[model samples]
Target: MINMSILKSLGLSINPKLHVTVLTGAGISIESGVPIFRGKGSMWEIPEARRLAMRASPPWNNKETWEFYEWRRKLVSQCKPNAAHYTLVEMENYFENFCLITQNVDGLHIKAGSKRVLELHGNMWKGRCMKCGKIIDLPETPLKTLPPCCECGYPLRPHVVQFGEPIDNKILIEALKASKEAELFLVIGTSGVVSPASQMPILALENGAKVIEINPNPTVLTPYMSLSIRGKAAETLPKLWKSFFTD
Candidate 1:
């Protein structure tokens, strides 16, 4: 269990006035049965999968790409939001300024009832037209076509920041702004290695925000965190919230 005294010393509490920003990754969703693509047991680590993902882009192997994401979307749809997701929803309601920045495209945060989420990567539940750039929400079931088409007769790609693709500038700007203004930053279940997203915590720290890391393993940012709580987010976050606030 994390020592509450440590949190108190850092000036983080159940105060409604505090501005809290949370950054999440695949780890948070793992307990809910989501498979991560980078770490051990990652599907992407498999050579064929890696090759497919690498070439899974429009104007390339669009069929394989769409099939891959379609499979993922179906898999994610079968999972439910876990305790950690609910804990975040509670935090959002308790704080005046709460921003959630997630690298996950699963859309679980929204399903968990968090309102102020900034998706660094686009959502899997949505698609963007390759030709006209129109974004649309995907249905729960897989599409009948390999690459679904937009009204303009152009193929619609998964609304995600594909490998080698740059993150949307507007989303990046908002994340940076939130990090800079945060009083407390929570790093949850991320690898802490990916660039840009990895820099969010650094921005928060530079701006004088106290950071708390919640992960079962040590990450690159662990050494710099104000307090490190070693546990799965589903098990750790609820206890942390209960320690701070009780209804």
Candidate 2:
């Protein structure tokens, strides 16, 4: 259990008016039956699948991408919002200035009713036209065709950033700014190995936010944590919320 006294001493309260930003990874979704890709001891993740998402020939298009995304989309669609997700929504409601920055493209945060979410990686449910750049929401049901076509007759690709693709500068800028501006920042369920995502909490720390990490195991960034609460997010978050944010 997290020692609330230690956190309270750091100015955490039932309701903080301060700006709060949370960065979440796959571990939070495990209770929803979602496989964690980037956590400590995770067996495997999306790399193999992402590679399959790309095409072989000249254009190097996301030829098989549709296959992977469709499978992924169906997998995610089966998962529901867990307690941790609901707790974040409650936190968002309590904190006047709050933002959720998630590395997972699973779309659970939005589904859980968090309004100010920045999906650092785009959601699988969205796709962009390879030809005209028109982005659209993909259907939950199986597509009739392999690679869906855009209104312009061009192949569409999942909106998610490919492995080698640099994060969209605008999104990175927003996440960084949020980290700097936050008075309290939470890193949840991440192993802290991935770039950019791993860097956000450090920015929050340097900028003087009370940085907290909630994970089942200590990660590389554990050394820098102002306070580390070791536990699975599904179980820990709701308890933390009840302890700190409830009447």
* Model 1 pairs whose backbones collide: none
Candidate 2 C-alpha lDDT tens digits along 156-246:
7777877777887888899999999988899999888899999999999999999989998889999999988998888888876676643
Flag regions of model 2 displaced more than 4 Å: 3-7, 12-16, 38-63
lDDT of 1 by residue, 39-150 (tens): 5888776676677666575553267788778767877899889999999999999888999999999999999999989999999988788678798877666788877777
> Which of the numbered candidates is closest to the native, going by highest TM-score?
1
Counting clashing residue pairs in each candidate, in order, gives: 0, 0
> lDDT score of model 2?
0.80
Q: Which ten residues in a row have the lowest lDDT in candidate 2?
A: 52-61
Each model's TM-score?
0.91, 0.87
- Please, what is the whole-model Cα lDDT of each candidate in the order they appear? 0.86, 0.80
Worst 10 residues of 1 by lDDT: 52-61
Candidate 1 displacement at residue 197 in angstroms:
0.9
